[model samples]
Target: MPVLAQDAPIRVGGTLPLTGPLAGVGAIHKLAAEVFVERVNARGGILGRKLEYVLLDDQSQPANARTLYERLVTADNVDLLMGPYGTSSIIAAMGVAQRYNKLLVQSSLGDPSLAPYDMQFPALPIGAEPQITDTEVLLDAYAGMATPPKTIAFVTSKFPSALTIAKGGQEVAAARGLETVLSLEYEFGTKDLGAIANRIKAADPDILWSGAVGMEAVQLLDAMARIEYKPKRHFYLFPAPGPTAAHPHAEGLTTLTWFEEHEPFLANAGAADFVAAYNERAKAVGFPYPHAEYQAAAEYAAWQILAAAAEGAGKLDDAAMAEWLRANTVQTALGPRTFEGKFNAGKASTKLKQVQNKQWVTVWPADLRPSGSQFVAP
Candidate 1:
């Protein structure tokens, strides 16, 4: 029950999984928001007031996120609201934001379809919709190969985010005339990846896709290797960063994401400034400063959106900000984007990348594609 001071600051609030499974992600999001606050305040603050972000630790639990969000709006009285990381946490917080009608801006919650949630939960989610460009790029990349994969297998986790990704992939695959050889669902943290991998090998699919998170992606890869079953292309929705999946057997490992480093040309110096300031503060407190971390960049972009909308609206009211979202486009670090009623109303920001030669190389989204970064087969 932390208390907010009766100070003149544009107080924003959200939940983060700061102490549980997703603590690393939560820490990055918090770092981004804090860095944004520091940078903005240094530039005379927002509307003559410092921006204050009140992030609560939801412990990577949706139930805790919902309650904390309720407390954020009802008890803490946050002036503006933001969504938490991951789909389930965001979904849980969305209802709370809607109940209060706060201008809810989202960053990392990457389900392209907010329509179903609108119908099911009946909340007006007002913010930039995540551009889910990775799935299509994935299917198309596979389709372009000399001998395109005709059969696909979906190895998915039961997490809402994973399910959403799996569903989106299935729809895209079906449209592309690819047959579903096997669609397997496993619970996250289930110690049965070997069994799932065995099933996948038995199915003998051409392309293998997994909608699991972090270490699960590695586990699946390990299982596939142990069984000596390799697909033409293995698309993992979430991957642990670095060269962990770049070994010979892991050659074809892939993931569609906007979470990678933004091209140098597209990089925003303002974002860099935030990083500089963030690093300074982190160094002072002995906290690690994640430089150029994609998740942090995305959350920082959300703060930029809020600042632009608040300035454009010339008020702190949610509806006023909503109006601003309707009319104005903001040049975020990611790119030029406008809110298409809580969605990316423009081109998607996602790209397909693969682990090649122990490095993550961008292979799709024609504008960002690099030389020799071909969508080479697995």
Candidate 2:
């Protein structure tokens, strides 16, 4: 390998939904990425060169993401690319990365199957088949209850990833002998959830599975509250952590998580420090939920993977970085992640978390739960 000049900073460019529907959670990713870069540069940077992150707002639009990422690669001439926040945007960025044969380390892509690009690597630990693996994890937690749910009602978003996961959950429920009383699908950005809430209240199943993202979960819960209908139990697929936790109806609201600001998870190398840094940054910006959770952890982990690949390869070469990531496990805030599976995905280390006492905490998989935390019956 030829020696590269250290006078210039290595730029990593990407997009985030900083000012749109997904902005709430996208802010978490943005803050986390900022902290990661700050810490990395403070520690002498990557391969002795300073690290620079070039971020653009996609406004939660896939088409905007496609255009912005093209600008990052062609116009700005970024040396590396970081993947965007949502599934649709990530897919758009992936196309640009594939075209340029660059390594894309992404955090929040909902659907993994859509990523056919070999250079793309996922930082979220949802595994290659989250539709099956994630559903199984949730159902497994439910099964540990004294009286397991016998019937379920699924309210899904027509968003590509949510639809796929919701349909897969129905199959997994049937296989587990859980009857589906009612299943509903609505447009991705539906605001008025009254009619859907009314129908769900009418069905009144043992558990309600909502494939909601961003503020959709809060909207559904509020609509249900208006109708005086609260299911015995409920699970949200990809909710915005802060908003969902702050909602009054979100207590005991279950969701999937790979990291939480608690023991075991915080025991990972640099996890506690990252949490402290994120809390300070989030609080400084007047963020509602100032605690570090799965979203922040995943975003930090994505940066960790990129840095690890670059350092391990001893350069900022895209192919060399991807090769290094495939050959070794990167220690991340979510723990050690190995990109050995399909599309450079790691194992499905999904854990169940819930809002307890207005805080998101891991409660399932007894062993990984906080000292006194246990799965609360909803």
Candidate 3:
């Protein structure tokens, strides 16, 4: 029997929500991957083999994700897997990848529970310490204030992302001797934030924390405007301020960010160039890309993984590639990364940012601050 040729240019497949409730967030990351593949192919492909990305729309459905991933691995014979953008979708895909012993590179999924899994690859750099614990940092800052915000509100939707952030935030508040005057959970995509906004205004929280989506972020801002109630401060996650067109309301709102906009790591080198290119592309498309720093950081890291594994394996096959990726240290724009098992145990997550002027200015968590937080209520 003739030996099957190795090093074949094969397919890499996974799930992505190109449309649905979380469509905006999903589309941004999907577009980023598309752009990354385009750049890779333009540069003569990886290891002299043209890379083909096989994307399927999970449509924000977990069941759909399982179905698509099964197709990728069983039917289409994908060389490897890149996980989906959300927590639920990634978890579903991870199950399949492990079952098939296929390598799965994941971006945008931060379940923390998924960290224990073996088949998963942390496509983005891991934090030195858990970045999710940063809510305490903010709470501590409040406690030390001459006068702490007498009333604090914690609001989030029932989505997994919101729940995770709220869980961490609540823990911080509890540890810091701060009281959560109101902790409420709304259904995802609830447009009528008026009641919620009114309740919050009546309570008069010193700090208004929003653990919701970009649309909800906009809804909160709109409702606040209508009710003429603005908290002295607002903290947010997920619906990052200033990064989207909805940024009008998010202006000056503070929240945690996955990337630092002007960090030396991101300010100079190939990663910086990538960010500039993404910005240019966003402008050309008439819809500026959301999460430029985060998306750029992820794509740059993915390319690093691909390059390191390709160089190490000296050929392309899912098993060989997975082995190389697990064992090798990939030099990324962030820095040198060595994945400890399936997770990158070496990297640290950066702190949060506040939207000032018209840009995301890094603040909090001490290490990656570009400038002192200048978040004053407008």
Using lDDT as the measure, which candidate wins?
2
Task: Point out the higher-scoring one by lDDT: 2 or 3.
Answer: 2
Q: Any runs in candidate 3 off by more than 4 Å, and if so which?
A: 1-8, 126-132, 140-150, 240-246, 267-269, 289-291, 317-320, 341-347, 365-378
Every model: Cα RMSD to truth: 4.7, 2.2, 3.5
lDDT tens readout by residue for model 1, 1-378? 653543478788988888875665676678778878887888888877888788888988889999999999889988888888777788788878777776677776656465233311111122333223456777777766778788999889887767767877788888878899999898766655889889988988888888867557767777878888887678887654432344556675777655345465236636556556655665565443324445666777788888888888888878887777666777666555655533433445566777776666667765665555676684
- For candidate 3, write residues 117-200 as lDDT tens digits: 664566655442343555765664455456776557888887675677787777777666667888888987788899999888
Residues 1-378 of candidate 2 have per-residue lDDT tens digits of: 655666688899999999888899999999999999999899988888889999999998999999999999999999899999989999999998899999999998878899989889898888888888878988898887889899999999888899999999999999999999999999988999999999999999998999998989999999999999888899999998998999988888899999999888888868999999999999999999999999999999999999999889998899999889889988999999998878677788988998899998887787988887778984
In candidate 3, clashing pairs total 5
- Runs off by more than 4 Å, candidate 1: 1-7, 112-134, 226-230, 242-250, 262-294, 341-347
Error of 1 at 175 (Å): 3.0
Position 193, candidate 2: lDDT: 98
Clashing pairs in 1: 129-342, 129-343
TM-score of each: 0.83, 0.97, 0.86
Q: For every model in order, what is the number of clashing pairs?
A: 2, 0, 5
Assess each prediction's global lDDT (C-alpha) against the native.
Answer: 0.69, 0.91, 0.68
Minimal lDDT window, size 10, model 2: 1-10
